[model samples]
Target chain A: MNKYIQDTHAHVLIWLEEAANMIRESFTEQLIIETKSNFSDLVTNMDKSVQNFFIQKIMEYYPTHQILGEESAEQFKDTNREHVWVIDPIDGTANFVKQQDHFCILISYYENDIGKLGYIYDVMNKNLYYAIENAGVFLNNSKLPTPPAISLQEGLVSIDVRNWYGKASLERLATEAFDIRYFGCGGIDSIHVITGKFAAFAASIAGPWDIAAQRIFAKELGLCVSKFDGSDVNYLKGGNWVISNKAAYEDLLTIVKEF
Target chain B: MNKYIQDTHAHVLIWLEEAANMIRESFTEQLIIETKSNFSDLVTNMDKSVQNFFIQKIMEYYPTHQILGEESAEQFKDTNREHVWVIDPIDGTANFVKQQDHFCILISYYENDIGKLGYIYDVMNKNLYYAIENAGVFLNNSKLPTPPAISLQEGLVSIDVRNWYGKASLERLATEAFDIRYFGCGGIDSIHVITGKFAAFAASIAGPWDIAAQRIFAKELGLCVSKFDGSDVNYLKGGNWVISNKAAYEDLLTIVKEF
Candidate 1:
């Protein structure tokens, strides 16, 4: 790793830990909440507060760095900055507002449109999954081995249940894939894939912040990140993305192509 | 509570903790796994071992108490005994084999078909939720208050996504209930409803061990446990069932009646 990227990664790790602690402490506080795109899409006082906290730290450490965050994306005027940090202060806001668990913090650092560092911090579980480009991935300092390539017929997939309820793919999966489950939190659900627990995660709808860090992690972990039709994933403009073990990617796409 | 029941509850609590520890310890051991019913429905050696451990404890303390467990149900001949125990040594065995996190243990004691004591232990999380016949439910040492009567649209429902993926109910739930998710583990999914995090859980298929303990806890929590069509839930039969909060039960039923 280059000195600049290495230094930034170390600094971000410390800041990420601080952010996690902030979220843990906020559990006892009353969460001021509001609806977003719909009633199901929620935002809480902590969402904005956490984003602001990261913004302040980034500005202090590197004043020129640009940030695109869930709660404050409007303030991030499209810029040609070298260091761009994409963040979802709380990826699963509804889970955060309701269950107060399973949700996670997603942060990705990119230098000139190239991924540099990524982190998916499962706050409640105290699991910080981070990846440094080309150096390999680690779960709390323990290097993660490349997950075994599993086909859908012998694999479990975390699918977006809402989209498939009216689709034929759900039926095909019932008898095809080993089984299907949903955790409602993309970051936590993706952790299942990274650790070889789940074979794939089919997300029909997502936001930029919801998938940016996962995209970086997938690249380093030998996993496929793509649109269901077997197209490249536009991480900046999120939609239907299939994150899966290579062996299951094409098979799952054939099943959920309509979704 | 009567002295006999109270003493049994206390004694069982201690045994449940010991069982939880046994599960935690088995994580590092090489698991002997076999498929049951289907490739997705898995059974591990730990499941049999844990069941044997519980069986040993119960048979030693209360020799006359009859036991019905997932691993050894074949050995449990149909009986008309006064005291019967329904147990799932490791509920969500697929999860236990894959994630090793979400699966749990379910135990229910009945006297002539009347529930006397029930326990659902989330082994990884170390949450032992128990209920008494006349008394209410408790999580660990703390008592759980009555959950609010949440309506369908205002609540989260953990529905069987596989059923909706190919059925009409998926469309109905999309526009009817607030949202739907599935954890694939009946016991862990029910935890969401037991804590009021989810208003209902619609299971199209289940085994006795899957819903037996949940039914006992549902009764004391003022929740409804029945078929998705509002019929009765035969714990032994393992068919469609809807375990829901009072207000959302009928509303959810109206949406997925055809499921």
Candidate 2:
């Protein structure tokens, strides 16, 4: 690891801890919430505040670095850059507003187009899952081995429940996978895949911020991250994506692609 | 509360804590796993061991009590008894085998055909939700207020993911509720509705032990517990069931009952 990257990792951890504290404190205070795109798609006051916090820190240190965030303060056009940061301050805002838990914060750093550092902070659970390219993934200082290859028949999968309502996605997985579960939060649900607890996660719709951190971390752990059709993911242009164990990826793609 | 009932509550809580410890210990060791009715329906060695432990304690402490357990060694048929206990040592066996979390221990006690005391212990989360007949429902030591009546359009719901493999149950809720989620564990999913986090839970298939504890606890919290067909639940006979909040029940029934 480069000296600069090492220092940056420490700084990011410090910032994440501070962000987690802000979320905890927000729970005791009243939040201002509004919907985006649709009723189920929600954003809370903390989402905007947290996103602003990250942008402020990034601008102060790496002033010219490109950034793509959920609540972007100053939008930067997609470009090949030496340093780029992707952030989703609150990945599952609906869970944050209704359940007050299960949501997570996602942060990823790409240096010269290579995914260098990725962090998925499960705030309520106090879990920090991160990956540093080939250096391997860690769940809060504990090194997590690349998960074993699991097949659809023997594994459980998490699917965005709303996507299953149309019958096609639900029926395809119902016959192949052992069962399905929904945590309704991308970062939290994807952690199950990272730890080998679940074989895959298929979300029909998502934004760049939603799948950005997951893509970077999944690459380090030997997990497959691709569009629903098994094509390479364009991190800057997120759509339907499937993150799965090596063996389970093909099975998930076959089903999720149909939707 | 009578002296006998109060003492029984204390004894039950004490035994539950011990059972939780036993579960934690088993997770550190290899558990013998086997299928029950089919491939997805599983029963671990710990499930049987836990059930046996509870039965033994109950028999020794209250020999005259009639009991119905998932893994019953001594058959105690349904009889007119002053005390009857229903136990599902490990409610979500598939989850216990796969995720090692989300599973729970369920126990319900009835006196002379009337539900008296009920306990749903989420073993992994260490949340013990209980109800004492007319007494208020509680999670750990904190009393939970009766959840407000939430309408279908404004509430979240849970459905056994397997149940949605077919289009009937899926579309019934897809168009009505705000959204849907699946935890793959009945006890864990019901906890969401118990706390007003979710409006309802609909499972197409379940056994007596799967819902006995929820039935007792839901009654006290003023939540509706019934069959999917809007008929009364036969707690001793395994069948489909719906447990919902007061206002959400009618809307759910209007759709679910059709299936």
Question: Looking at candidate 1, what TM-score does chain B attain?
Answer: 0.96
Q: Lowest summed-lDDT stretch of 10 residues in model 1 chain B?
A: B159-168
lDDT: worst 10-residue window of model 2 chain A: A72-81
Model 1, docking class? medium
Model 2's CAPRI class is: medium
**In model 2, where do residues sit more than 4 Å from their true spots?**
none
TM-scores, all candidates, are 0.95, 0.97
* Chain A TM-score relative to the true structure, per candidate: 0.96, 0.96
Error of 2 at B40 (Å): 0.6
Among residues 3 or more apart in sequence or in different chains, the pairs in candidate 1 whose N, CA or C atoms overlap within 3 Å are none
Q: Which stretches of candidate 1 lie over 4 Å from their true place?
A: A77-81, B75-81
Q: What is candidate 2's lDDT per residue for A60-80, written digit by digit as tens?
A: 888888998988724767655
